[model samples]
Target: MKKILPGLLLLSAALSCTNKNEKMEPYKWPDAKAPIADIKPFTRILHGDTVVDNYYWMIDYFKKGPDSTKVVDYLSAENKYLDTMMSGSKAFREDLFKELKGRIKEKDESVPVFNNGYYYYSKTEDGKQYYKYCRKKGDLNAKEEVLLDVDEMAKGHPYYSATGFSISPDNKLIAYGVDKVSRRQYTLYIKNLETGEIFKDQIDNTEGDAVWAADNKTLFYTSKNPVTLLSEKIKKHKLGTDAKQDVIVYEEKDKSNYIGAGKSKSGKYIFIYSSATLSDEIRMIDASKPDDAFKVFQPRMKDVKYDVVALDDKFLIVTNWNATNFRLMETPLNQTGRENWKEVIPNRKDVLLSGVDEFKDYIVLAERKNGLAQLRVRSLNGPEHYIDFGEPTYTARIGSNPDYNSKTVRYIYTSMTTPISTYDYDMVTKEKVLKKQQEIIGGYNKEDYVTERLFATAKDGTKIPISLVYKKGLKKDGTAPLLLYAYGSYGSSMDAGFSSNNLSLLNRGFVYAIAHIRGGQEMGRYWYDDGKLMKKMNTFTDFIDCGKFLIDQKFTGKGHLYAQGGSAGGLLMGAVINLAPDLWNGILAHVPFVDVVNTMLDESIPLTTNEFDEWGNPKDKEAYFYMKSYSPYENIDKKDYPNMLVTTGLHDSQVQYFEPAKWVAKLRATKTDKHLLLLKTDMDFGHGGASGRFDYLKDVSLNYAFLFSLEGITK
Candidate 1:
């Protein structure tokens, strides 16, 4: 049996003692009333189901209606309530922030990447919020030319993102994009590197990437829809011409498909890619011919997704045509069609061919086997071999290998106990050199920590992988606190990567574990297929099972186990709490997508149409009921619930702020428990809070403080 702390034991007993028919005593707090959102009583009749929502008006901020002020005011009230309730830990939060921030090396420089006759890198100075993008010509010892000083450029802006630095083929000019607001809509600007002159031409609402044509005077970029913020059109622009007159090279007809323009690695062709959840199409034109129309490489096919990579005489395709696990196929440049594609690397049942990095003489394939990443180097006409990571479980992916003529390939490797390390491997000589490893300013010792890969059997008989890390002296008596985390959606695998911030938890005797659930591609394509759409329930159940497994193994007691997830994972947190309300001691949901049915039903919302395949179209009736059945917001009942700290940003473009805000409003009014249900909203930021490096640590510190306060740990 697991030993439980007195406070946790009391909380658990209160929940276990509560009966469904009786009103349970709410846990007493610091004597502050949680925000009560005004009831508007909105009715929705969909698929023969009648639903009335009291906090539906919370979405008025996005609608820009009269209730917009009310929405903001309500959010402010919740923020104030959270502050007052957690006021006891105010000083602790600040100290925790400094401790987290102190681990980072204040002055840092990235490994310079050699591209197009220049070695480019970004370096950050101590105390600066951002970095300076600089490049050296010929070699590393050459004079440095600072392209963009983002620290200086972000002077007056609260949220500024500078990205997509595209240098012209001639290397005399450069184009970049900037977003002052956190909405992800970037304004493209061109600058003359030779004379340091800022051009008058500017393109607005672009996806940020600017693909330069061989002529150096023309550029191609993807434009986004103002409302949905979806990449909708590819346009061509001349150096000195007005953006209004830019020609529309191609426009995506299907709202589900996102389109983007990019140059081939060989610099021989400019390709426009259109992709959806299960389908893809590519169009290409010669880089020298900017005025020429792009020819279709492959027509979009249902349930068949493929990506193209250009080479000297052939184009490689990574596709799922007949293979559930993707395979590599190649076709001649002249015959760019699916019919002409010949299998270069046949599909294997065990290994998933994720991607390929092309080069002049060698090709590096990124493969995944048994839920771990691997890099395979293959010579065009020679032998192939997998690069040994020397670890049973770790993530290894092909990094930057831009120069086609270089025999060496760059790859990144990291494990739960290992810091992220970069390496350059000679594909021909089979030799590898470690370029750099992440430096933790406050010394770290791998020997002081223990990492383990465990398996938890799900209810459906599937073995779910769990990656965990803790301090060396961990006891299996279940007295320690454990935090289980996962993001089981979009085929995104939550691999075990090192985090300096996680040291704060491990050092405090908290066992941090990642549940490699079904929805992720960790176990290959079948794993993802079994956890999405109608089978989405597997995701929630898998996470619940993982937590139970941890408890069964005496890792932690149910009252000491905490759960966390963000975005889609937040949905997981919400669902798990509803399905197994008494299972977790505390939950931290970051920008949670709790309102699933309503958000999926509304096509006007950004990313809704694009996600129809992932979540299923609710208009079909079946998906609507299925989604509502597990939706966190819809399933909230008058029951004892775990303490939760829900966070969101006012300008969140991904999972909108209204989802969490409304969910919290409903939870406060509905839940019987008085456990901490605090909602922290970053009013100035969006989905990803704090653009600055040190600023994000503050949010992390607040989260740590919440967990510490619950466990009664104050440093």
Candidate 2:
């Protein structure tokens, strides 16, 4: 075990002092000895670069090697240390958890989505951990039939996930998927709604989606590789037959591409999609003819990604082949080749065509313009218009419109200050009706909050959007604490949305902000293209600039500002800390992916091969050096770092548990700071913390307590 450094002694001494004028005493963390991990030096020579990783043995748990037990012991020790240090906040953490959970409506039902001849919805009970999937046939007042009692099914499991509920064409049989261990490998099961009996045919190791043919007996699902957990093959299964006899319909030859099976909304064709980051190819077969061979819609082209939506006589294609912002094209149902496609909506430099939801009389286009979502409704007869969300910064997207014959289109709208709202709009009348709005158990008045959309200038002269919300009448005196969050990777935009848990911070005088940095498609494909690969530094720099901008504007000072991100965004948190450690007082990284070079270099990782286009593969010398340059674990130095709370799940398959474990171990040994560095690993769950909605708030409460304790805002 390593001895405590002088810097840690200084930190302990400083904890005794507090502001004399303050009303409450400053939080004094327990002086418990942090567990020091034993270093087992491991060396690797990659692209002529020699590196020695002292904590590399932490990866043994996943490999099931002799050292696996040791890795678990190390992680357990870290968890115990965290508990000991935070023991002072036990009651405070409970209060925070209850406060955050209290705002959520315990008994709630989602707006019923009318599909085929039935209206399907899920409702949660007061004290239950899960909801029940129920449906009503014929009309909204019809008799309710309970399909799945997830609360009962999840009784004995520590983690449970039920998803991908697909009903047969005749609506008599239902296909669903379940994951008990939270590793994302779901087992597909079929249940007869007419007779409350589950079939004996159960298929394991699937992607959790099952598309049914018109025959109602044939099911198509994507199979996953047992080792890497990658979606590798599409297979067909007969209702009563053994899953072992399932025929492989399509096997993805390219390891980098992921494949999935789905039926079109029109129920006319079944599609098998093979997609990578930059390219994709689609195959389709008639849903009525399950035994027929599938035909390719279009051959895969380099750097081209196109999704198809089947229409009555034609197929609509949203492709980025010749348009950087993507354009809408159409081809006859029979002639689905690139050469036969004709442009319908020409690409605009300012607008990005993200998706299309087709209906009988109209098609709604999900678009992004200037970092905000827009729903454009276009009639088959040629008139088009966009739905007005009436917020400066908000997210608006097409919701569940399963009924093709209905003229009303459903959409969801939410902003930083607004609760999620569902609306049904009549395309012809141009009017909308509010179907439902999220109810906050405790009274919530939007007038008590102030939401703003501001821009921060990046180092390269690009303007980055910053959406923030705080209690009304906030003083710009740089005395308040602020939490800044962002997720900038894989073209996934972090849009402004409402969170009930955020009220805890706001009510406590904390300003919550989201930095819309590059690497996300907020500003279109160009924004994402410029923030990845060689330009990945832009993501970290943009976040730093946002932090500086907030401080410059007197919103918060350097020592009171906090930053957070998760998964790839967690990578963002790791990079920014290494780049500008003094810019933040605290950081909350959930299931962080911090070991960039090592994780990317190893192809056996769950998402490494699939994300080669997002995070360049390290096999190439250029990619290796670039990734190594910013990897948080590799770049740790003898410098002060902000207090941090890092979280990961031991069973996580996406980012893996070892990445953060190795990262925290290295940071603890190398950093010169005496500040808090904590790691919390949920042994039973995976990438996503908990299976239950309410139970997840415990993790959130822990994070809030950490931030609050640092700012001396204990409840």
Candidate 3:
């Protein structure tokens, strides 16, 4: 994970001149007292320790709809109270939203992807709330075929998502899934592109993806368990058959493992995968023989995770078996066991073999070396080369290339200061053609902004990476308000990509930074290992250290520093406030999993069983005590905490809305300071708050407005 570059870490300390138009006048917020929820006393005995939970009744609201329980009433009350308190910033929020919207090219279309005989793409109109999926035959100039008008489909609903637009191999039929309620349980629908006829066979509670068989009429789809929402079954359905008659091809009895099915690029076989956090098993089925039983290619083994793809007669496997950083191997189709797996790409302790994409004569591998994405193209017999992005710091990844016989490889590349650009590269000729770059409707100059890489020394002596970007002349002068963000769990690296929307903050003198903490594999697999289970607190501490490092460098000082994180990162915000309440003036926590102990202890919860490996199973004595020590809800104290704005969705399926609802309630009751503490719950959406593209910006505007309100900014 270590590599050397010349002078990549140097940042100039020039001060940017303040804009007159960005100046603000202080405004007084209406004096109001926040609502206080009545807390009923409750207690739980775990590992011989007595825990008292005053807001325990919040869980009941999750089990039942908000309408049937007092939870909905409490959430509504909180929303009303927050709206009233933030009334002074309403117009500022609107102006911010408008400015954000103006940056987007309203009538924008995606780059067309060629598959089979059609070039397909999705476009959004100026006034539409959703995309319109369309395609053309033979050539780009040919007459267009409207596959699905999501705008028309989402017309009457407050929340609507259309997913998995998989076309049959025969190219005559389309299979897609729709979810009106954002709980993510989609209903499958089949449409005949030739006749424009919609079939009546509807499959409910599915994962929204379908893998088509060689026989166009038959397809395989994964189903979700009703309670936990985990994908657990794969079933085969005939195009014209009733949903009740679909055959259950495979059922995963292990509740911790997630199951899904996909068709190979060769279109010769369908692969079904059952995966847990540390183990995985894959099975294969011949696409031509639709009714044949799947054969297990590898048996499930603990801590030996692998993914499979097929060539003509051999299977390429990417696995972590005996390879801490992962590697690529190949095995004959008939000899599908570990002993028969021969190394294709030797394991490099410093590089992570992320994934593999196959073509007729070449294979594209997505690897991570030195915390940066490296896309490599290797020929079957000729040569191997890495695509040069020609930038010091940026993100580049393999994009859509569905045709197995094509020589062109599609990829996307971008950075904190660069617009998202797409390109098609010729594997043989090494020719790169630019397809498109997202048009920031209002004029945007890349030279007006600058990005830099910085290192923060953690208490453990590990150097953490921080990606920062700001207006060109921003100085390291302890004056500009900084918004530090990090999500240091699940090994999910937060990519530092360009966003026209974020310019609203940059132009307003806010420095944005992403902390590449230990929980992310950005520095390799060991980086993630250092931040999970017993060492989970490192994720929180690293973030605090990064914030201080920025201050030490004079980017921002005490009380002027601001932080934001959602979900797991929200937990970061919660933990930091408890550990160091003097660090910031205000913070935002969205859909936080603050009640970690209780949530993890209950096996019935949606993500509980599946995440046992990440956050240890609390049933064990050692694990129970370890998690309870850092859980935000249990760590609340009677001291001053940072001013906070917490948001959640009433229908959130992942981190239940009640987690934040309960945390805020406990904070209000325990803390002595009269700082602003607000909760805004969206009554319509789920874990991902808004379904519409433009509508979600309003939430972003609200968060910005909340920060601006404290900073004395006005519209």
Give the number of the best model, judged by lDDT: 2
lDDT: which is higher, 2 or 3? 2
Measured against the true structure, the TM-scores of the candidates, in listed sequence, are 0.96, 0.97, 0.96
Please rank every candidate by TM-score, starting with the best.
2, 3, 1
Residues 423-442, model 1: lDDT tens digits: 99998889999999998665
lDDT of 2: 0.91
Pairs that collide, model 2: none
Best by TM-score: 2
Which parts of model 1 have CA positions greater than 4 angstroms off? 1-29
Lowest summed lDDT over 10 consecutive residues: which window, candidate 2? 12-21
Q: Write the per-residue lDDT of candidate 3 for residues 290-353, one digit (tens) a residue.
A: 8999999989988898999888879999999999888899999889999899998988988988
Per-residue accuracy of model 2 over 178-275 as CA lDDT, tens digit each: 99998999999999999999999899999997999999999999999988999999999999999999999999989889999988889999999999
For model 1 the TM-score comes to 0.96
For candidate 1, the per-residue lDDT at 52 reads: 98
* lDDT by candidate, in order shown: 0.89, 0.91, 0.86
Cα lDDT for residue 74, candidate 1: 95
The list of candidate 3 runs beyond 4 A from truth reads: 1-27, 65-68
Task: Give lDDT: candidate 1, residue 564.
Answer: 95
Stretches > 4 Å off in candidate 2: 1-25
